[model samples]
Target: MWLPQPVHALPERLAQLIWGWALAWWRIVYLGAVVLVLVLSPSSYSRVGRHLLARRMYLDTLPILLGFTALAALLSLIITRIVVVTALSYGLSRYALEMVIRVLVLELIPLTAAMFVAMRCAIPSGAQLAQLRRSGRLVVLERTGADPVRMELLPRVVAAGFASVTLAALSCVVALAMAYFSVFGLGTAGLVSFTRMFGHVFSPEVTLVFVLKTVFFSLAIAVIPMTAGMYDLGASERRSELGGLARMFAVLLLIELVSLVGNYY
Candidate 1:
């Protein structure tokens, strides 16, 4: 019968469809992200918000955020500079800023910052949480009537988020500066037009979208690993490790897809 062949082909076809759909929806997610973050930003909220702020972004998270912010800024400068130089060398300097804007700011920086944190902290945080769960530490705390939210989850979650946002913001600043110098070359001459373009692309709506997207990007990085870690608790160590990485990467990709859709559509 042809049934087995059809069944086998089904998964492949489904995968292709999913992948295509993901690409289509991802832009919308990016466009929607900024607003989400701004609305949920610490300044936007009240005292109750402070607790959420601590949970999402706090001192413990500061170190990683600082490190990532610096890293992202440097990387943005290097990458943008390279693109500009390459363009000018090829006698296509006109395309430099626009290409840099599209590449570094619109797509690469946001995604890159997310991916970096996901790899560095998200995976490790998952492993740590999963190990705690496997060791029954989470349960034991419960026996003693302890709060996992404060002792364990909060710190890591906060760190993951702050790091994500810090890196993202830093990268954006660097990208803007790199674009400036690359285009205007040590002058304030392109200030008006460049600023206009910046304003054009970063409309209040776009900014709102980007804020939402970045925050969610942070959330995904933090939450997915934590979720996986929760499941891995009380499981085999190897299984927990594998599960953490798998879940973190999966969540990162899902976030990326969501942002993409929100941006374009």
Candidate 2:
């Protein structure tokens, strides 16, 4: 007995999908490796190169840092208040600080920072790179003896990664301060207990996981959108943007899940 045509087509479609996904991941890894080499190489830091990197870093980081910190502070204040009030109502006030630290500082702030940078910097940079590629400017630069990847793309990636990490770090501090104030209300009476609780929550293993997760989040925000944009240059602008964002978010979600499992499970 012969199988239906639809059944055969389904397997072919599945294989195609798997192949495409694997190829996309391979390209992202390849690009990331190339960028890493360029970043570490001494020759990539000529005077002009240093200037480009510095300028991109400034553009990526300073302008948005204040706004992001304020947003993080507001969210931290609201969440800490809710957690403290709820914990007090349940007579579980002892756990409120721990919960606040774990939820806001460990999980939410890094993810938020990554997304914010992706939107503000990564996605647009990727789109610009894609346009340059599509318009053959990259080839023109290559013919002129300029390494387009080194001179154009590398700084953007580095700046974006730095921005994500910086934003997360700053926001984490803000969140912790907010958590303290919300729980203790402008007094030093809780200082010792707060430090003890903070230390307890950030054990070596947990601390390692948190650091790794934030780093991975920064990497994803830095790399994924650019990879998607560069490789999907044939697609329409809106579609490319959406696709890049979708892939970035998917990687971020996977990273978050892994971190959650490592931290809690």
Cα lDDT of candidate 1 equals 0.68
Q: Assess each prediction's global lDDT (C-alpha) against the native.
A: 0.68, 0.90
When summed lDDT is taken over every stretch of 10 residues in candidate 1, the lowest stretch is 23-32
Among all candidates shown, the one with the greatest lDDT: 2
Poorest lDDT segment (10 consecutive residues) of candidate 2: 231-240
Q: RMSD for all candidates, in order, please.
A: 7.9, 3.2
lDDT of 2 by residue, 1-265 (tens): 9956777698899997798668767877998898889889999899999999999999999999999999999999999999999999999999998999999999999999999999999989998888888888888999999998887889999999999999999999999999999888899999999999999999999999999999999889998888865664353556656766787889999999999999999
User: What is candidate 1's lDDT per residue for 54-108, written digit by digit as tens?
Assistant: 7545544555666766775676677778888898899988667776776677667
Q: 23 in model 1: Cα distance from truth in Å?
A: 26
Instruction: State in Å the error of residue 116, model 2.
Output: 0.9
TM-score of 1: 0.68
What's the distance in Å from true for residue 115, model 2?
A: 0.8
